[model samples]
Target: DEPLDDENLIDYGLDSVRMMGLAARWRKVHGDIDFVMLAKNPTIDAWWALLSRGVE
Candidate 1:
């Protein structure tokens, strides 16, 4: 059951700890990534947009 692009990750069991871990790992490649960014909008489309933009 894949989650929808607009679906909130938290509703799919993505807690703070897991989100933090993801932020840490992704931040290695995407320096702009952070917990607050993800927490602000926990949706696949939003995250994809952020990650795809690439940091300056």
Candidate 2:
């Protein structure tokens, strides 16, 4: 089943290693993106909010 935008990614088997990998990849562009930030709220909406923002 596909996760909803508001659904928790961790609930769908998104583990820390994968999260870190994604954070690392995204950090290349979105410098502020970190594992901790994603881990705090692992949802598509939250990530989109972060990713779409201009780095400060």
lDDT of each: 0.91, 0.94
CA lDDT, candidate 1, residue 41:
98
Q: To one decimal, what is the Cα RMSD in angstroms of model 1 from the true structure? A: 2.3
Candidate 2 lDDT over 1-56, as tens digits, reads: 99999999889999999999999999998888899999999999999999989755
For every model in order, what is the number of clashing pairs?
0, 0
In model 2, residue pairs whose N, Cα or C atoms come closer than 3 Å (at least 3 residues apart or on different chains), thus clashing, are none
Tell me, by lDDT, which candidate is best: 2
Deviating ranges (above 4 Å) for candidate 2? none
Indicate which candidate wins on TM-score.
Answer: 2
